[model samples]
Target: MDLLHHFPHARQRPLRELLAEKQTWVNQDKKGFLRYRALLNELRHIRATWLDLNSDVVHIGRPSDLSPADRVHLQAALCSLKPWRKGPFSVFGIEIDAEWRSERKWNRLIPELPDLSGKIVADIGSNNGYYMFRMAFHHPTLVLGFEPYVHHYYTFNLLNSFAGLSNLQNTLLGIEHLSLFPESFDVIFCMGILYHRPSPIESLQALHVALKPGGSIIVESQAIPGEEPVALFPEHTYAKVPGTWFVPTATCLQHWMQRAGFHNIRCFCAHEMSSEEQRQTPWMEFESFQDFIDKDNPGLTIEGYPAPRRVFFAANKN
Candidate 1:
């Protein structure tokens, strides 16, 4: 829970002050997330001496190179955290086929990103630090990921330790808590989480406050395809995922960004999600995107809302 000690010398004081302000909440979270204490202890047994950082696969180590006993131990420790939703990692010898083909998302987002060399970055709603690992390839000064879920937070820390990365840090915090710092980050990535918030505009405002002047934000969100600036407010659920509030078009998102004090907004790419991009895999044995869409008409969700399409936006704070 003492996080600032992990930071570099220059960042320690500011981060330490922030943590001191939130010490009580952090203590409660430490207790809440440490429920998987046994599995976490077992994870300490994994050791990876080899690494490939720049590649799309992000190979940790070869499984065949490990003894049979060690390989089994590695798999057991990883599988203990089931329903893995964000990766397709090759750790040691086992291939963890996660629910989302995150590599594809990485490829799509990378081309749109500015050069991140030596920049401080924040990834909001970072599920298991998939993108944070990818962002590390750019030699960013630091990559901080905020994930509220306890399981995903632990999973990211476990994977980061396996990767032996010093530049990336994952914390068990929510995007709403970005208010703790002002003008702290150079780039903020808020992906696939806008529709979940009842007040997406306020969330964007918080992101603006967190960024340095002229800092850019990369927003990836679920959208209902259209040229008009409109948003869908589902009565209850969208795509069978509860808590979904709004699915806006690309134009609507641009407008929202402008209203939230961002300028020079650009809709880089908007694509419909394919079934291959998300499906139940060995690591995640649960319902996936396909299950939420209507089988009779692939263009609509079970609730008869528009099918899932995603849009990426790049905007700057002025």
Candidate 2:
């Protein structure tokens, strides 16, 4: 796909150069690229006949589209891309029960979501384009997803190839690339990404710059419980997940936004996560939420920190 065609405004901004750099990095390790290509080759021939992105499962095609042998091939192709983290998608009647029941999180934010008609939106850390596909139902002019992980980038590409959402696009990029898109988006969703950054304030500032004036940013992150304007800098990891730098209280998160110059900040939802929300499934057969928390004390992580609780906040660029 010619990604540059979608961003005419960004054509002169080194976007192409950046994409080239990313592609070089992806191919730098020839062995890894070949391994990834081998898995992707499995789904290159399969395509969905029809799709309904608005549904809970993000239905795609029908079971009858495939013969018995084709069905087996399709399932095997999907399994090769295991650890599906953010969807409950149904592709040609084959259900993918991913680790996270992402619809639950989407439901919590949908009520507060602004009308997306004719808007340009970005979804950071958009694993497998689950949220991007859902956002498409609102008829956004564009829904660009940034997922640097090779597995997710290809997973989205395969699904999009089948579903053929012209307005939905995935890029092998991450939050660090947002600077190239200054004032480019109408709405930005930065979910499950903040805490991973070592500098939350700087990350928010980058997000601030990426938005057009008055554009909204919806943020969702793992948070701790407290009214104090403080954050928990984990000694090593949180909930057994590494790269988690700081888990802030809801108020602290709001304060971070204020410092970053966002206006009309609202911390709307705060809910404790549970195994029911994110657990192991056939598609994602890895240790999950249940294993991350203490066996005896569910209120704390196995690392002895407060258990995982997620908070949603929305604010607009001033």
Candidate 3:
């Protein structure tokens, strides 16, 4: 008998919840889906708190002022998503700062990151050369960063010049241009950047060609954590806002990875955070989140902030 038949009620509630959630999410109007907007609201609130207290706290752009086109660009940046500045570490444009950390820091994810020394790696959509700077310092790898923004290119290059980080190279091209290359990299990172494009899957396919058959790619994305994802663009917000295809679940991420011809996929969440870290870090803006959740779901007690966010998925091109 099918294992699913053995436990008939196993997926019933989750399935029902997911279906209803999707329906409601799709029905949301203008401002944004109740769910995602809540996440943003809490983030904004936390950001305000952080800025008031922490003098050195880094902040990205505000979402409200974004044009529909810019919103899509922001989605691609995954720029709005968190884990923002990798804890204030720097040197030689390389992070010699003690705060710099690897996936190893987030024990909940069980990230199997390899030593970057001496391998050829591709940093797709390298915003501000954050990853490039880090890898340039510790891992002896030849890292190439592809970023389309001119200002970022200039700033990153200037930093590279000052730090004299020979291991890192910056380019002003989109991942779609990967077709120009015939060789493969030892590793490719597509972090927080795919959602902006009209074709995230196509971007994935482009990476497949850019990678060695067995090379791996790190995919970090913003997705609806519980139930199902709610679409913000289709419902409203702005006329030119591009839709963010939130994976909605770990399984959904696995599906996308599989379709991209990646193998041996792994996934994880941030919710497995330590208790103190969860409560102490004010970024877990629950009060503001509750307000938005309450607006869309008055009868429900869905506290949004601090909810598990953005899934981490990785797999090999093989």
Give per-residue CA lDDT, model 3, range 1-318, as digits (tens).
Answer: 221222232344553454366446534774544433443333332111111111122222233444566445434333223223233322212221112232333333334554566777888878656567555544645777877664455445543443455667766666876654434577877776665655766777787777776777777764444544232222321112234433335566566667878888887443332222222122122322233233454332243232334567768866
Give the Å error, residue 41, model 3.
Answer: 40
C-alpha lDDT (0 to 100) for residue 53 of candidate 2: 81
TM agreement with the true structure for every prediction: 0.90, 0.95, 0.55
Compared with the true structure, the alpha-carbon lDDT of candidate 2 equals 0.88
Q: Give the per-residue Cα lDDT of candidate 3 at 163.
A: 43
Q: What value does the lDDT take at residue 95 in candidate 1?
A: 75
Q: Return the lDDT, model 2, position 96.
A: 94
- Stretches of candidate 2 off by over 4 Å are 5-13, 27-29
Q: What lDDT does the true structure give each of the candidates?
A: 0.82, 0.88, 0.50
N/CA/C clash count, model 3: 4
Better of 1 and 3 by lDDT: 1
Q: On a 0 to 100 scale, what is the lDDT of residue 66 in model 2? A: 80
List the RMSD of every prediction in angstroms: 3.1, 1.7, 17.8
**Residue-level lDDT tens digits of model 1 in 156-242:** 877877787888887766788777657888899999999999999999998998888889899999999788999999998898888
